[model samples]
Target: MSSDADRDGDARPGPGRAQRDHWERTYGAHPGMYGDEPSAPAVRAAEVFLALGARNVLELGAGHGRDALFFARSGLTVTAADFSPAGLDQLGARATADGLSDRVTTAVVDVRDPLPFADASVDAVFAHMLLCMALSTEEIHSLVAEVRRVLRPGGTFVYTVRHTGDAHYGAGTGHGDDIWEHGGFAVHFFSRALVDALVEGWTLDEVIAFEEGDLPRRLWRVTQTRR
Candidate 1:
């Protein structure tokens, strides 16, 4: 098997075609790798979304449509987008199975480029474990800007990323706050200060840092209004 670092090194953009092809192959090989359920952080983020009374919700990298399904089940209009057609296929199947075909819409989108939505079209945007996949800080910032651009005035942007202070910073071992690059793919770490700087226009609502077992994690829940 190829190491994570090897995979990170091979993961790069190529006129959209290559990127889409790569993820398609990956998801095709492992149809439901991310499973049919949302992660713990996503569940936690949903609580905040519920409290905010958000109606039109966008999941930037909706891998398996897990969180998207959660929002749809709550009666929110959801647009679940991913870069991989294979992933979207699985998500669509899951949505149909959950009887959310009407409430959930699936799209193939790559966040590294301009988002496929009109400005201020979405009420809230949620991305779980999406930022770290970016190859560089510039890409990360661009993704954030895209999220900001699509969000309505006073919309909320909630996401969770690996904590920077973790012990295994960058080995693709899910440790520490280091940038792990392997097999054309990478995971970037972020500190609270870095996130604040990246999210320049957004208000810093809350930065929660905690350890899950041996790993340290950070949850950033920010609510920003359009300026």
Candidate 2:
């Protein structure tokens, strides 16, 4: 007998692709889920970019445009990208409402694929809690390479990731490669070594320890510059 799994074939997407559906539903269920305020990291990143005279930025995993809109308001041209179209729609609507449509643009991007921008194109990049998504180590490395490819020389890249010290690090269902799923959300907790490894060939600026949310998720905000 051909079971349901057999009939469906082996076309199932990996956890990373499945996350797109989860995020779509999440955004649909709760628009502006992360609130309208810019996160602490975004505010700090803006300071860094402005100090460096950065005029444009590419933001990955930009959900609902809270930080992207903030960057636009800070007088930087912004490109916001995420895998979920629903999230981008909300971001677009909010940008229009805030009269930031001209300053901000939205693109649906899966970081696993090559980035859409040209080489040495952007002045800065910011990703908050993005690298910690259900991506594997190899995918993370590839995405970082793409980030470097798109950023101009001396461009700044600021990103945050939930680290191994987080309360939920070993909790929930383990999906291998340090990925854990809880309440429909999957995360790849980062080790210190992994963080150091990602900075290869770049000038490592600083790694700050921080906490966020009710769970007080432990995270490291990493800043680096292209040599």
Candidate 3:
């Protein structure tokens, strides 16, 4: 989550339209609420992907497409996935207007479910603060497995998550050990132990403290690779 508020602009909408109907209404009401610039984590992660020679990137919870547009502008083809129809539509329109439509595709997805892409089809997976949503430990692990399955050998998965040390960690209603519900959204904070567990069966490249937004969301910028 981009500083517990946004990831690449803190996309607050989540899950599918069924149970989490709030997200649909939220996106519909506040279309393009986020700024145009991608988050700082996404900016840095794009450099890492390019260094790894990644060509195709699948971005989950793409929100308003700030990071997706940045990746496309940097010459990487991006599949921008989000659950909100309004968010996806805004992203599509922006991509077309920016002349990056050929380099970008938008999809509505429930991250808790199976990813729609074919196995070993992508060069990298970029999930900016998408992991901190209402996902449980098992579901988070499963999502990682899906990322691993969808990436070609040597592909990278670059993502960000709010760290437990942030001021907001214990402020919200407890959903789990490190999960909190506040402002009508649930966020799962991460510790190093959880990070290690999340990167199992993969090569952990780095985990750094990343601060963002005015409140300064303390977060972990995690980079891993499929063996």
Candidate 4:
């Protein structure tokens, strides 16, 4: 679920601006950069949701709605949320083309801002590789709390993050924390300790290691259920 990054020869800290702008420009510049197919982690998540009888899914950072459409087609109503307006538009276009507009909803939501979903409204929350994006440990924990708040009791929060075991983990510009920036993108690598700390108030179901892409982007697929 992790996105590609340049780790070989990246420079010092990128200048500060809205992270949303970076993502918007990234999507706008390269259409279908991540492609239309649902990621492997997403496919596994859909299976877990169906097993849990989750009828509605809230997907954070649902770029291009790939995973959202997969969930919707699997009979779960999906709300595909992302900060990039253009990304949402692409997702809407695809949903329309696939005649899934009825089952899928799109929203422009910045995860750094408060989530717009009502409390205890969704049966499941899924965010693939979104938790690793340029967020501090505090911010990541806060976001998880919000995810928990928006889930019904026993609803699952499924997410993935770049693992500290990744080959790219220590190669980029170091933040002296778990985070590192390369090619203007920041990724907060997750350790078992950090994940253990973040899963407070939820039951940790799994933390499986996996890889994606030719860079062999190593990741941890962590799952938690609201208590």
Clashes of each: 25, 0, 5, 0
lDDT of 3 by residue, 28-128 (tens): 88887778988888888899999989999999989889999999999999999887767888899999999999999988777777888889999999988
TM-score for predicted model 2 compared with the true structure? 0.94
Better of 1 and 2 by TM-score: 2
Please provide, for model 4 over 46-161, each residue's C-alpha lDDT reduced to its tens digit, 9 standing for 90 to 100.
99999999999999999888899999889999999987778888899989999999999998776755687789999999999899987777778889999999999999989999
Q: Write the per-residue lDDT of candidate 1 for residues 43-128, one digit (tens) a residue.
A: 77677777877888898778777788888887788999887767888889988887889988887776766777889998888887
TM-score of each: 0.80, 0.94, 0.89, 0.90
Error of 4 at 69 (Å): 1.1
* RMSD versus native structure for model 1: 6.1
Q: Please give the distance, in angstroms, between residue 44's alpha carbon in candidate 4 and its true position after superposition.
A: 0.5
Q: Over the full model, what C-alpha lDDT does candidate 3 score relative to the true structure?
A: 0.83
Residue 38's lDDT within candidate 4 is: 92
Local accuracy by lDDT, each model: 0.70, 0.91, 0.83, 0.84
Decoy 4 TM-score against native: 0.90
> Which ranges of candidate 2 are over 4 A from the true structure?
1-13
RMSD to true structure for each model, in Å? 6.1, 5.4, 6.1, 6.0
Error of 4 at 178 (Å): 1.8
- Candidate 4's error at 223, in angstroms? 1.0
lDDT of 1 at 157: 87
Whole-model alpha-carbon lDDT for candidate 1: 0.70
